[model samples]
Structures are given as structure tokens and as C-alpha cells.
Target: MDMGIEINTRFGRLGINTTDALIDIKSRMPVVEARSKPPRVRIDTQHVQVSIDQKQCFAEVGLKPADVFAKEMAQKSRSKGLKAIADIARKGDTLARVDKNPNAIPALAKGVMGKRLDYTVAALPRSRPRVSFSGGVDINWDMGYVQLRAATSRPEITATRAGVDVYILQKAAVDIKYTRDGFDTTI
Candidate 1:
């Protein structure tokens, strides 16, 4: 006449405090049936941190040719203004056929060549000397200081029931350190 049963929730803490059972005098109840324990191997370890920063400076500027075109009068597409007056009337009389006005010289070559040409930079391209100084002064303040480290070790499960090899889960050894700050600047 012996029986035991004790279970705690949250998927843990279970103690039947077994004394082995066998009591069934026709149906007194105690045939033994209490086995619920197979879930215990929780290991979690993870830590990661990273930081990177790189700043560079160097410049030279001088550009001047501000014609940025715009003479207006650019209207060509009556089949290219009649194919440029039919190639200047087959190369012999187009000033609008000597001024009879077939739209006079393609309206003066679409007013001297179809306008709209831009280049406005005759005085604003000046940054030729900042010489590195954004955490790398003159080029070596940890030239873009970068550090990366990672660790995730704890996963080596080995188990054998009868061939003489109990159980083992040991694998934790991974440490890394890297740093590069300054002197390799190419902008």
C-alpha cells in the first residue's frame, strides 16, 4: 500500500516521491502510473556589441564656364523643321529660299541653335583643404575606429545510454576583438 504524486507547474518541479506502487485488491487503486519528467536542458547565452565611425576630408575646386546656354527660340520638330529646310534646300538656297520666307533660315537656325544649355559653376567649388578631422585628425585618430566582438558558445550535446557514455554538453569558448582607427582614407 504505497503511492505518491506531486507535480508543480510552469513545466518544472515534479516529485512523485515514489515508493513503487502495487495495491489493487480488486480495485483499491494503486497500480503505479506517474511518469512525466523529460524536459530539462535550457542554456542561453548571447552578448553582442558593435561600434564604427569614420570621417574623412579632402577637397579641391575650380570651375568656370558659365555660359549655361539659353538663347531661347528652340522649336524644331515639324519633322525637324522640315529636315533643316530640306538640308538647306539641297545645299543651295535656304535663307528661306533667299528670303521668300519658308520660315526664314529655319527661323534663324531656331534662333541661333536651339537654346537651353546650362553650366553655372564659374565660382562655387571651393573645399580644397579640410584635411581630415572628424575623429581622425590629419588621418589617424583611430582611422574610423571600429570594434566588433561576438560570443555564442554552449552547444555540444553528447549522450549514450548503454555503450558507456553518459551525457555531455560543453562548448563555450569564442572571444574576438578587432579595432581599426585611422590612416586609409580614400574619398
Candidate 2:
């Protein structure tokens, strides 16, 4: 009852034709109160995008430093110790490609609007907080179904470099199919 087309942009993976693999992780944030306003705690919703990378099937998710988990790092000694699990995950193995361009700020949008384009990148790191790149997906079509033959991954970043880890890899995909509800030719 389920079918799908997959595109492995190397660093991250994309799923077409179905939405069975999407996941959302929510965390309780701290409560901020103003002198005259009521206290409201922040909430984080991390969207997990699955990717087919590396040699093994791996996952890539995130947690902010000020969130509940990070806030209780000292108290949740057991939870903090379990972070080793992520250490065991090879770079490209899990959850498709997480924040391909950790600093590149992949335009949140990817399309040629006539002669212009608009996009967004992952949120930048702040003084003491970070964000998870969960809802990182875009889609387009020429008419019918579109499948990716190649993978276009985001560029990873570091203090000394940008776009070093990710690049315009290659012709990640090739082919286009347009589905129609036309009558079948009787044999």
C-alpha cells in the first residue's frame, strides 16, 4: 500500500512519492518572564529528515544547548553519557544529511522564479544556543512525477572554511515522468 522514489544527494537523502518516514521531536524549553508579563516557556520542534548515506543506515538529529536535555546535562548524567550513541554514528550514515551546510545557510527556498531565486539556510549559531535542521526540504516539478537520480548535499562548515564539505557534486539525477489518468489501450 506504499510506494516511493528516493534521491540520495549524498550528504542528505530525499524521499518522493510518499511521506512515511517523516518524524518530529519536541522538547520543553525554559520559561522566560518579563516584569509585567506572564511566564512562557519556549518549545522546540525538531523535524527529522531521513537520509540514505554512508555504508550503513544512520540517523542525524539535534538538541539545543539551552533546551531541557542540554539544560539538565549535569543532572541527567545518564542521558549525557548516552551521547556516545551519536559518536558511534558515522558522518554520512544516519538521517540522510544533517545541515549539509552548517554555515552556508542553504536558501530556505530553491527555485528559479522567472529570473530570480529565493532560498534560506540553516539558522546561524548564537552565543550559547544552536538549532536543529529538521524541516529542511524543498520540492519542484515540471508536470508529473520527479525523481532524483543524483544527490545534492549541503556544504558543511568550520571556522576556517565554507562550502568545503559540500559541493556541486554531479548530475545527481536524470529523468522526468508525467503521470496521466488517460484510458488504457485494451489488448
Candidate 3:
């Protein structure tokens, strides 16, 4: 007696799906600003001034005596004897005298005869005129300055991860057959 057996098999298959990663980035640059101011200046000035005084000079020139005779007469008027004689003559002598003799010597009186005679003498002034002068100047200044400002922003980024999916499309299978004396026995 002879026995035989035969078998058939089929393998399973799988399917897969994949996805790629993605990234996005955004950036911003820094900014700067500056400002400046100019300096300021100011100036002040006063003009020169002058003043002159000539009152004393003019009075000295106008009141000076003309000659030595007038100066001597002015000095004799202040003597005590001359002043007493003048007083006595004014009080007692009122008659006029006539000179009939030609041989009488001329009399010289040592005194001022004028009723209006100035005795006070003015002092002489300096050769140069009196002068005064004044002047001034002032200056002011202000310093300059500068201002600066700066700003910056952070960067932004976005990202995505990769992913994969798998699934079975078919399952494994097997078939068996037996034969006895060349005749099929099992199916």
C-alpha cells in the first residue's frame, strides 16, 4: 500500500503610507534712531562813554587880574590902617580941595578906591580837562546734546513631525490533498 499527500500555501502582504516633515521660520531685524541738537550762543555789549568838566577852567580865565597895579591895589585894600582912613574920610571930609600952588608934590594913596572891587581870587585849573570813560562786554554759551534709541524683535519658528501608517492587505492560506491507491480520498 502507498500513501501520498500534496499541499499549497499563499503569503500575506502589507501596505504602508509615509508623510514628510515641514518647517517654517520668520525673522525681524533691529531698528535704530538718533537725534541731535545744535549749540546756542549769545553776546551782549555796551558802548564806550566819555564825560568832560570845564567849569573851573573857564572861571579862572575870566577872573584873572589884568595887570600888576590892579593886583597891588587889591592887596592894600585889606590893610587895617587903610580901612580906618577910608572910614574917617567918608564921615568927616565932604568939602572939595582946590590946588592953587603948582609946587605941591603929588600924593600917592595905597588903597583901593573903587566901591565895587572883587577881592576873592579864583584858583587855576589843571592843564588837562577832567575826563571819565566806561565800557563793558558779556558772553554766554549753551552746550549741545544727542539722543539715541534702539529696538529689536525676537524670531518665530513653526515645525511639524513626520508620520507613517501601515495596514495588512491579505492573510496567509494553505490547502492540503490526500490520495490512496491513486484515488482522491480527502478534499
Candidate 4:
């Protein structure tokens, strides 16, 4: 099934033409051209409708970050988990030394709370504002959720026609048409 699995919950569909990838890259995407618009990232598209004013970079699943992390860590040996934790700590220390920012982790971790994981606005016409690194910070013990490997699309799409296959994944889609009409239900 071609479900809503595109990245950033896209605002428009990206039609992959028969042309070369470079040629397609040269062609600019249709922009909404609105001032103070929401963030938009162009991932490979599918048959899904996206509304404007969307937020967040990734969809928040029924699975919690803590739970997922624990499960993943559990799959590995105790020594592996310890090593991973050590690696994270080393990276943190490196950042602290280089940037001279004591509160680096605390400040950099304001990205992982919402279902949407991206936002964009014309900060300046000449200046291209971009957020390269964003993630959730450790609330208590300074843990971070990195490396997303969530399954997108269904198994049926990948299944062969000769045999019958069953997929037990949720039909997930992010509502892109976010509005600030808290009180007005005049739609």
C-alpha cells in the first residue's frame, strides 16, 4: 500500500519524471510563495494530500522515544549498550569543548517533542536558513534519540503478485493543513 510515508509530511507531490536526476534537480519545485510559511522538505512523494501550515519533521508514532530506545538497546548486548552510551558522551564532550557552549545539549535538543519535525520561513531573501541537526535531548540522564529507521509504506507494495502476503502496519498520515483557528469552526 502506498500510504502517507513521505518525509516532512510534504506539502506537494514530487513527480519523479523520466528525465535525468540532475535535470529534475535543476527544475525548481512549485513553491506556495507565502510569507512566514511553515517548513517544507521535499521527500520522494506518493498519493497523499498535504495541507499548508504543517509542523514537525517526523510523525510521532504510538511508540514512545524512551520505549523504542530501550528496545533497541536491549536487542544488543550490555557491553554494546554501554559502548553506545560512551560514544554519545564523547560526542557531547567534543561539542562542549569546540563551541565553548556549556548548554549545548540543552539548547540543541528542542526538536523532538512534536509530530512535525520541520519548519521553514524566509528569514531573509539572500540568506538561506536551514537546520542541519535536530533531535531530542535527554530529559533526565541526557539521552538522545538519533538514527530513525521507521518503516514506511506497506509490505503489499513490495509483495509479488504470484503469492499472497499480509502486512500489519498502521495507515499513517500526517495532517498538513494546520490552522490557528482555535475558536472558529467555520469550515
On TM-score, the candidate that comes out on top is 3
What is the C-alpha lDDT profile of model 2 across 3-82, one tens digit per residue?
Answer: 34544443434433422343344444444433333344444454676553322111112343355446566667766567
lDDT of 1 at 168: 31
What is the C-alpha local distance difference test score of each model? 0.42, 0.42, 0.68, 0.46
Model 2's alpha-carbon lDDT is 0.42
Q: Which pairs of residues have clashing backbones in candidate 4?
A: 39-119, 39-120, 55-116, 56-116, 56-117, 56-118, 57-116, 57-117, 57-118
lDDT of 3 by residue, 24-51 (tens): 8898887988888888888888897887
Better candidate by lDDT, 3 or 4: 3
Superposed Cα deviation of residue 168, candidate 3 (Å) = 2.5
What's the true lDDT of residue 72 in model 3? 60
What's the CA error at residue 127 for candidate 2, in Å? 36
Write one digit per residue (lDDT tens) for candidate 4, span 34-130.
3343444444434444343212222122233666658766776787978879868876676768557666666446422435658876422342333
Q: What TM-score quantifies how close candidate 2 is to the native fold? A: 0.11
Off by over 4 Å in 1: 1-101, 113-123, 126-187
Per-candidate TM equals: 0.15, 0.11, 0.34, 0.15
Residue-by-residue lDDT tens digits, candidate 1, 1-187: 2233444333223333323333322223334434443444444443433333211111123222233122122332456788888876664655537657677656667766768989776543333333332222132222233344444344445543333333334433444444445456555
Q: Which 10-residue window of candidate 2 scores lowest in summed lDDT?
A: 52-61
